[model samples]
Target: MRFRHPDGSIVHLAYCTNVHPAEDLDGVIAQLNGCSSLVRKELDVPVLGVGLWLANTLADRLANSSDALNRLKQALARNNLEVVTLNGFPYAGFHDRVVGKKVYLPDWTESARLDYTLDLVKVLADLLPDDASYGSISTLPLAWRVPWSRTRDAAARDAFNRLENRLAQVEATTGRRIRVAIEPEPGCVLEMIPQAAHWLTPYSGRSLIGLCLDTCHLAVQFEQPVDAFAVLARAGVEVVKSQVSAALQIADPSDPAARELLAEFAEPKFLHQTREYGGPGVDDLDLVGELSGHASWRVHFHVPVHAAPRPPLTSTTDVLDESLRHLVGGAHPLTHHLESETYTWSVLPSAPKNQQELAEGIAGELAWLRGRLVGLGLEEIK
Candidate 1:
């Protein structure tokens, strides 16, 4: 939440919590408060903003809208946390419907969805103080829910139109010009940087509709950090929010080599003969094979199963640093939240080392980022 420059100056840094450990309001607030305390004490900086996950928290509290809004307001006020931006929302409600079917006819007309989305935005906008800024509410492409093969130019155009129309309503209702960040995800219609740029061509020059560059998603698309940033800049797409993450590209466990090896050990013929003779058949052979192969493949492709004092060849630090540099060096002033969204952290073998690792990893990233930002003449928090 804060960073210090080499010159000994301090500045407030903003970020979000992607790992949701709490489902209740009190629990969520406690987590936020704890994070804020660490930022204030350890980082020695003020908390500028926080990102909210709408799907898990807000959606559940929908029936108690007034109470939910009040609780959110109280949480922010108590922790001295300001709303930087909100990601998953309005769109997440129809996630299953959109992704399950290859079409995104939003169950409502463009006007209807626009009104509904805006109404929700208004409630969130009202939650923030007059001087506070709200970052992008997600603007999902219709094709995001649909399959890639089914996403044609005509469908894309219609989707874009619907998005633009709804965004306009959001702007009107909020009475605050919030950016509608179009996030790119793997397998979604806007999977690649080029695809996202192409879709944003009409609104690229506009500030209202922008892009949210999520590193993990981009990694999945095999986009290099520098190249991805360049594409956004070239397209004149404003990055409303930025996330940091690493991808784990594991080999398929059911590949030929793995299958053959499993077959060799289990030997289907042996199992059949044993079954006929009422002998001890293979004990859950499928489960054994799956577990063994998965374990083997995980160790084969990812970083070493153990941690090293020095950085490993497979460490994602370099790419993450490059991404931070790209943002720090960009012309547009970086607003919103710089979320440490390494969601796959638990999947990594080094995750069980306790809170020290979590704290150290986050602090290390912030330290590296601060150095870059300070080099760019941005004031750092002490």
Candidate 2:
């Protein structure tokens, strides 16, 4: 779905397809026909935007094969879906049951990371609709903090410099501008908005490089939505994409009920970085045991935005609300894309029991977000 902000800028709303956990081109195509189509139908919209998560092999297939790319383009058209942005943070094995720090393996310092991203850029530029002027890809924030160093910064910078030039060439050839947004997560080289802004402040390629503001990360760091945007704007870093997600919140961590439910959430599939209010941040939920139970805790787990978890445990819905209002503030457009990115549907505490229910969950998030955006005075471009 698309909306026209009061500032007259088009904001494309999509649900990231990473929730489906497909691995190859055929799997991606099946997801479009099966899950994504169900989601579009559930919303009953003429067209719905999907922030696709293409796996490494699929990216290779599409970038190197015009035939494969055309099949993908045809599939989107048939499913009444469009792609203006992609979730490129997970190189592969995103759906693996034990995806921990390995998700950050091919960091920006590696040539493999640069090559994979370039393939995504090429594919995204071609996937963009003819009427769309830009496409965005969300990537990792450099690398994990532990293994990173000032010396490694040069390799990362050199990689991005090459990317900037290639982005320019893609835009010149396709007339669709593509920008990569570094998505900051807890324990990464860039932890949150302030760190990301500080790092990008010195970069000369401002236009082609930017940040992907994941509200889950924002809330985990206890950063207010309005103020976070201010930090990025101050450093001249553009918000190319915003993932409209909510993090799991427990106001009273000592509550036994909350802890019991939280245990259910601390699954082994993905990392759930946890933070204590105004205190230290842990890489996973188990580490939260080290923090004070008296303080509020926000987990990096993306929860359903439309509904709260069982009582006593909540979500950062307020953060998502504030961010949407700020995005449509009318002073200027902060970002062009917003994706309902609750990719942990399979492990959600209130997870759907079947494929039909899964589609409902995704459609429900988008519907809830659309209502909020409309209330914010953004006209739905139906």
Q: Which candidate is the best by lDDT?
A: 2
For 256-335, candidate 2 gives per-residue lDDT tens digits of 99999889898888999999998887889877778988799999999999888987889999998888777765566678
Best by TM-score: 2
Global lDDT of each model?
0.50, 0.89
For residue 372, give model 2's deviation from the true position in Å.
0.8
Cα lDDT, model 1, residue 90? 35
Candidate 1 clashing pairs, residues 3+ apart or interchain: 1-13, 3-381, 4-381, 10-380, 10-381, 10-382, 11-380, 11-381
The local distance difference test score of model 2 is 0.89
Superposed model 1: Cα runs more than 4 Å off:
2-13, 56-64, 89-120, 132-134, 138-146, 149-163, 169-174, 248-313, 330-337, 352-364
| TM-score, cand. 1 vs. native | 0.65
What shift in Å separates residue 99 of candidate 2 from its native position after superposition? 0.7
For all predicted structures, in order, the TM-scores are: 0.65, 0.97
The backbone clash count of each candidate, in order, is: 8, 0
